[model samples]
Target: MSESAQQIGEKSQVILHFDLKLNDGSAVDSTRVNNKPAKMVMGDGSLTPNFEKCLLGLSVGDKKAFSINANDAFGMPNPDNIYHVDRTKFASDAELKEGMIMGFAQPDGSEVPGIIRSVAGHSVTVDFNHPLAGQDVIFDVEIIDVK
Candidate 1:
């Protein structure tokens, strides 16, 4: 490759390492620590629209860090996302405990994750909100490739 490469465009494919953190510096995820790079097309659903927008015009080997509000990143937590399911849904073989995340199948055959919040005698509350909802997040990214 030459020393100068064109900046990323709308349809470019990108490879990068990223660190996602909370305002308090708690690590949500990181590709650098895993020694793996992430690759994604610009307009694909793999990357959030806001996150992709941040990468536009960046060239290879560029590193940048930025912060975004929760609503723009993962979104605010919705009260409707909390569900109270019947305790019987869990069979004896399955464990029913708080803070346990489970995948539930929907009518469209897609699976969404739900975290158990509480377990009562006959009711179980599950929260479907993303774990990072309603929090400010900081993103640190290093562009490894832009094609």
Candidate 2:
């Protein structure tokens, strides 16, 4: 099958370098150097629709680049995601610091990463939401090859 018509369970290898940036053109993530090949399964829900669409009909040694809008990338952040926690949760001996990354449990029995926001007398405010929740992100994808 052609790269664009790749089906689920198809085994393929492709090397790609990509840049993730904010709408303001701030770089967030990129796999430019140390180039590596990534294997993907179609219909696994791993790649966003927009991203998948861009990958369609590609071939090995085919170098194609494209950009994706925020909605198709990480989506916007939700305000309801911010949360608060008790300072005592961190052992008395533990030092609470701002910008600390911690894992918090969610109702779905999943761990959500949170960043420490502030430390008050007895409370530690944390933002469990993704740091880019409210912002739109840009994805720069390049297809190095496809099987």
Candidate 3:
């Protein structure tokens, strides 16, 4: 008994199994192990509109699969998202690892996360953009239950 996407509205708790893949048909992530279902509320930012649309009205024990483009997923990469920081920022005891996420403070008294791209003697290159930016992803989802 699968419900249509329209039946799954805002604030409705839904449990689903998700599988993510790249355009090359390579699997990236999945939640099928032990069938541990993930829950989410419709219309929440957790699931994109396009992705949610695919599950509009779906009853429990329903399985659905779909894909989202780069814009709908992680979005296109921005050139301005790259930044270089002084090597001194790293503590002497800290080891710089590429792809490591670090927090950066902004002038507005807020903090943002960035990933380490490269490490030079006196400079450390950090990329603030998301790791999946500029890439299209194919997501497969199954509605385990909707409450």
Per-residue lDDT tens digits for candidate 3, residues 1-147, read 434543566667888898888989887777886677778888877877777777776766666667788888878888799978898877888788998988878899899889999998889999989878888888887777677
Candidate 3 stretches greater than 4 Å from native: 1-6, 103-112
* TM-score of decoy 3: 0.80
Quote each prediction's TM-score.
Answer: 0.92, 0.70, 0.80
Displacement of the residue 56 alpha carbon in candidate 2, Å: 2.3
- Taking every candidate in turn, the Cα RMSD to the unseen true structure, in Å, is 1.7, 3.7, 3.1
Instruction: Give the CA lDDT, 0 to 100, for residue 127 in model 2.
Output: 79
Q: Rank candidates, TM-score, best first.
A: 1, 3, 2
Predicted candidate 2 versus true structure: per-residue lDDT over 1-147, tens digit per residue: 654543222334445566768767888877765565455654567666666676666654555546555556666666676667777777789777999987877789998788888998888988776676556666666665554
Tens digits of per-residue lDDT for model 1, 1-147: 644454778888889999999999999899988799999989988889998888888888799998999989999999999999998777767788899999999999999999999998889999999988898899899999887
Scored against the true structure, residue 28 in model 2 reaches a CA lDDT of 80
lDDT of 2 at 78: 66
lDDT of 2 at 117: 87
Q: State the displacement of the C-alpha of residue 80, model 1, in Å, after optimal TM-score superposition.
A: 1.0
Best by lDDT: 1
